[model samples]
Target: MDQNEIQFSYRARDDRGVFEVVPRVDGTPLTDLIDKFETDAGMRPSGDAYGGLVPQFFRFGPMEDHFHGRLGDAKTPLLGCECGEWGCWPLLARITTTDDLVIWDAFEQPHRPARDYTGFGPFRFDRHRYDDALGKLSRAVDEGS
Candidate 1:
């Protein structure tokens, strides 16, 4: 570990390896953990990787089903919203291993050791950060070729 590469931390549901075997938090063994995390956090997964588990956290009996902003404009980045609502949202992570997790923000900025998010959970990750991370991953994959 370099003295400079900060340890970005967050409290994810730790579903990195159960994609093919484990059942979801509910009886539905088919729910995608990612989608569950997003829906529960009141956000949307930025990828086409949802649809199966997009309803467990939703589908309540019409309490004015409000729609949070979607990731509009494929060419643009949708970082945190202008709304000030906060909660225990899940932090999306690109984990290298069980002990090596990186929580990225929409701007591609990782958590700093000196970060003072004293009220938020381990961290609060959103879509824009995921897009930035996807960009980084694409670059790495391209370079490896």
Candidate 2:
């Protein structure tokens, strides 16, 4: 989802360099980022949808658990709600450090002209573990069949 006014890149490992928890001011709104996370990445909310758990553009715990269970490793850079709740709150996240830090970028609602928030280092993950998980995620996104 490349736009003339915005640029997007991500590094799931330590070398990816996600040091700060600030919004990218390249003229792209937060909702567009979340849309990429959902449409391009295929990350969806994983609870009972009829129970008020709709598919979220950015879901932390479920994505973490999915990768963790498959890889049998615990190192990941992406972190989510500390209280373990799921919703379309986080717009995007990046691993700041190898395994003990991440910057969670979020928005109050998935709309423009809305309040936004940033969280620094909420979840921890190992670099290699993150790599493995990312590989799987990328494959899932690329090979949707």
Residues 1-145, candidate 1: write the lDDT tens digits. 3111221111122343111111122223212433444455444332223222111232322111111112221111111111211111222222121223323223211222232223322222343543344454334333422
The CA lDDT at 82 in model 1 is 14
Evaluate model 2: give its TM-score: 0.27
* Most accurate candidate by TM-score: 2
lDDT, candidate 2, at 103: 28
**Root-mean-square deviation of each candidate, in angstroms?**
16.3, 16.6
TM-score of each: 0.18, 0.27
Off by over 4 Å in 2: 1-90, 99-121
For each candidate in the order shown, give its overall lDDT on alpha carbons. 0.25, 0.31
TM-score quality measure for candidate 1: 0.18
lDDT of model 2 at residue 48?
A: 20
Model 2's lDDT to the true fold? 0.31
Candidate 2 lDDT over residue span 61-81, tens digit each: 343343333324333222222
Ten-residue region with minimum lDDT total, candidate 1: 78-87
